[model samples]
Target: MTLDLPLIWAGLIAFAVLAYVVLDGFDLGVGILFPLVQGEANKDEMMNSVAPVWDGNETWLVLGGGGLFAVFPLAYSIIMPALYAPIIIMLLALVFRGVAFEFRWKTRRGQFLWDWAFAFGSTVAAFAQGVALGALVQGIKVEGRAYAGGWWDWLTTFSLFTGAALVVGYALLGATWLILKTEDHVQRRAYTIAFWAAPLTLAMIGVVSLWTPFLHPLYVARWFGWPNILLAIPVPLLVLAAAYILLKGLTERRETSPFLAALSLFVLSFIGIGISFYPNIVPHSVTIWDAAAPDNSLSFLLVGAVVLVPLILGYTGYSYWVFRGKVKAVGGYH
Candidate 1:
């Protein structure tokens, strides 16, 4: 079968972003849950739970960005300039969090300081990405392939809502991860957080669903349209079912059910977004075909990705296999 370069690139972009969400999602969730952890021993256990896999998780972000730059240059050109401030803030937050993750355990005097920095950085990075996502969904002020909006244009009530929603969502992901990786006190605390966080996340999704249609008439029309509406309905229903199952599993203290349910929720939520924003990379601004790279470039990258992506998958699998068990409080960074 012949390949459609645009579809291939789109799939690659989607895979990269989803990988980032699931992989980095756990570490960020750990960060969001940082402040709630009590005692040095607990903190050490939390850190160990993620330390083996956290750095590797960021590979997806790099691939996602690279795919955007190589395959959808137009989207990158428009979005990078429009979100310059938030992008910078997000990068800085990642850097600080990475440093704190390592340095906090190497020293004795300023551990609290690093702990706060790690948590703050994680929250900042997660929220900023949400804001950027909201602004993209809302449509940037584009003029002749460049953004014409002011610095404050990105900061709106909608964006702020998106920011908070992402925090809750990531926290939920973190809680599920804890359920899988920790034991006793930490796992119990995670269950409690998941119980509350899931409902709040659902509320945020409802608000966003209602608000999007009003903010952009096309989205409203898309949902109201016959066949599309039928397809869309199942996504949300699946998510709700997954959320319910997650709560039930947490309540029953089922070992693996909570994480499976949470993972299903993430997958369903991603499908909902993908359905809403199909064909459009920058929402109302540009369609995927309009922003696609030259066919030759896409073909070359496809060749490279076939090799690189599998390697990433293999290494990620190996790391998880190597570290598969409840984390212990070893009291120091390796």
Candidate 2:
């Protein structure tokens, strides 16, 4: 079978985004959950749970951005300008997080300051991305190739809802990750959190699913229409089932099952969104084909992916393998 290079690139970009969501999602969830940690010891255990794999989890984000720049320059140009403020804030938050991660360990004094910074940064970054997702879904105010909306235009009720939903979603991911990576008290707390967070996330998904159609009539038609409806419904139903299993696993003291089930729900929900917005990179503003780069640029990127993607996969696998097992309260960073 011959390849459709544009679709192939689109798939690669989508895969990169999904990988980031799963990998970085847990760590960001950890960050969001930081403030709720009861004591220094618990916080240390929480941080350690993600320390080994957190850095590598960001690799998929780089791939997502780079892939877009290489294969969909038009979308990049449009999105970046429209999201300039949020993007700037996100970058700054990430920088703050990186610094806090290193410095939080180095100093005995000002430890609380660093902890707050880390948590704040994580919340900011997560919310900013959520707002961007909401704006994209709600459709950006575009005229020709430029963004014509006010700065506050991005901060709508829908965006705020998305922001809160993402925080809940990330918290759920973090809870399940902790369930998998920690033991004893930490694990118990995580399981409790998961039991609560999972249902909240499910409720958020339901709200977003219902709201999206009313927010965008086109999306409403797309979802309610004949053939597409058949494909779209199953993904959400599967996600709901996964969430149910996650809750059941937590209650049964099946530690590993919650993480797997949580991951499955995330993947299914992501796939549902992808299906809902097939061929549209920036919702109504830009179709994938219109936003995609020339075939020559795609071919060049494809050649690089041939080497880079496999190397990334190998490294990610190796890191996880090396760090596999429950987190222990080692005295210091190793």
Candidate 3:
């Protein structure tokens, strides 16, 4: 049997992107919630909670993007011109956020500036990502083999809404994370913020879910049409289940459950997206096979990915394990 190298590469890229979102998401959330959190000490705890593994979490982003460029060059070429603005903004925000993460510890007076920088950077990055996602989902304008859209084509009401939704979602993740990894007033505050954030996040998810299907006939058909409806129905049901767990965990004051539940929501949403975009790497325009590089290139890269992905998983898991438990009130990872 001929191995489906393109399909395999697509799955690998999808996993890498999901890993990046699941892992780096909370850390960005921590930054998003930075301003809402009062007191230098509380903020310290927030930063410290994610500091150990935050940078490491971005590895999957590198893997996902690099894999896309290498294994799906055609898709990359089309996507880059289409999303150049948001993608650049996201990268710059991440760079700024990283600089602030380190510099905040070194200076006493300038720390306030760094705090704002971190918050702004995280928010912008998350928003840009959501915008890019919305643009992609709305369908890129492709002419022949190239992106046909002009500059500012990516900016739309739907994309803006998705951007806001991602911000709220990330904030929810941050709040839930704090609930798990802090104590005293910080935890209490997290609970309060989460109480509000949870509902808003779910509402945003619902809006996006409803709004997405209308953007394209394919989406509408894939979601609500005929036999596809049978398969598609479970995503929202599972989202409800996850929401129940998240709310129950929050109400019950369970530390870890809420965080896990939040992650479940993201996972379910991602799966829903995959269901919509199956076979099409660039959506509407390009199939996985259509955009994929030659078989020889994919096979060569798969060998490296096989070795690399596991090492990333191992180290990432190890780091999280090592850093497990609450961050203390005094001092932090700098």
Candidate 4:
């Protein structure tokens, strides 16, 4: 049997990225919801709900970045330069969010400022990630294995729209998580957000669906042309089904179902993205094959990856398992 290095690395990195989005996404959602939460008690409950696991959730992002650099150095070289600013902004925002989470408890005098920092940081980070996604989807400029676009080219109209939509999406995810982890007023608020956020999320997805094909002829030709159109039916159907279930779960106040249903939407959305941009790791400009590292390096990396990836997964799973249940306001940040 032949070893397909590019395909293997793509799958590995894609898994890491998806894991980060789904796990860290909900916690970021919690942070984004901070401004809307009125009571300090409720806010502490929200923070407690995710405090144990948010740090672990971010580990996948680091793994994804490292995997990309090791397995596809050229893609990393081109993409890092093209998206230098937003990437830095996203990282700094995450740092600020983390710091706020830590220091908000220690300093009572400046607690209000820290709370705002956490909420603002979360919103900015999520928006920056959405901008990154939109920029890639809109396509990057690559010339002779180098970045061809200007520094500000990443901020197009579509990218901005995508950023706003991600805020909604992350908000929905956060709401569902609160439903599972909180009770009383906080949980009710979460239920309400989940109910209203459903439509806005779907609408954003709808607009992106309409706008994405026009970005490149390949997307139009691949997804809507000939028999490929027929094959793409399940994606939308699954998304609609998940959304319906999410709405139903929220309405009924089911604890676990809402979170599971929301996760389904994210997973399916990623699957849709994979279908749209398969083989192309960097959208139109660079492909998995075009930017893939040498076979020997991939082989060496695989040895560490095969062992390291599973350990990370196991640790992450164990952490969640350890912290599973409702979050009560324990008076202070324990």
| lDDT, candidate 1, 3-71, per-residue tens | 899888898889989888888987898999999989878887888889999999999999999899999
Error of 1 at 293 (Å): 1.2
Q: RMSD of model 3, in Å?
A: 1.3
lDDT per residue for candidate 4 within 291-329, as digits (tens), equals 898899999999999999999999988988888767887
Stretches of model 2 off by over 4 angstroms after superposition: 331-334
Local error of candidate 3 at 254, Å?
A: 1.3
lDDT of 2: 0.84
Compare the candidates by lDDT and give the number of the best one: 3
For 210-311, candidate 2 gives per-residue lDDT tens digits of: 888887777876788888888777887787789878889988989788888888977987887787677788777778888888888888889999899999
Worst 10 residues of 4 by lDDT: 325-334
- List TM-score per model, in order: 0.96, 0.95, 0.98, 0.97
C-alpha RMSD of each candidate structure in angstroms: 1.8, 1.7, 1.3, 1.5
Off by over 4 Å in 3: 331-334
- In model 1, pairs of residues that clash are none
The sequence of per-residue lDDT tens digits that candidate 3 reaches over residues 1-334 is: 9999999999999999999998899999999999998999888888889988989999999999999999999999999999999999999999989999899999998999999999999999999999999899899988889999999989999999999999999999999999989999889999999999999999999999989888888988888889988998999999999999999999999999999999999999999999898879997989999999999999999999889999999999999888887787575522
Query: Distance (Å) between predicted and true CA of 262, model 3?
Result: 0.5
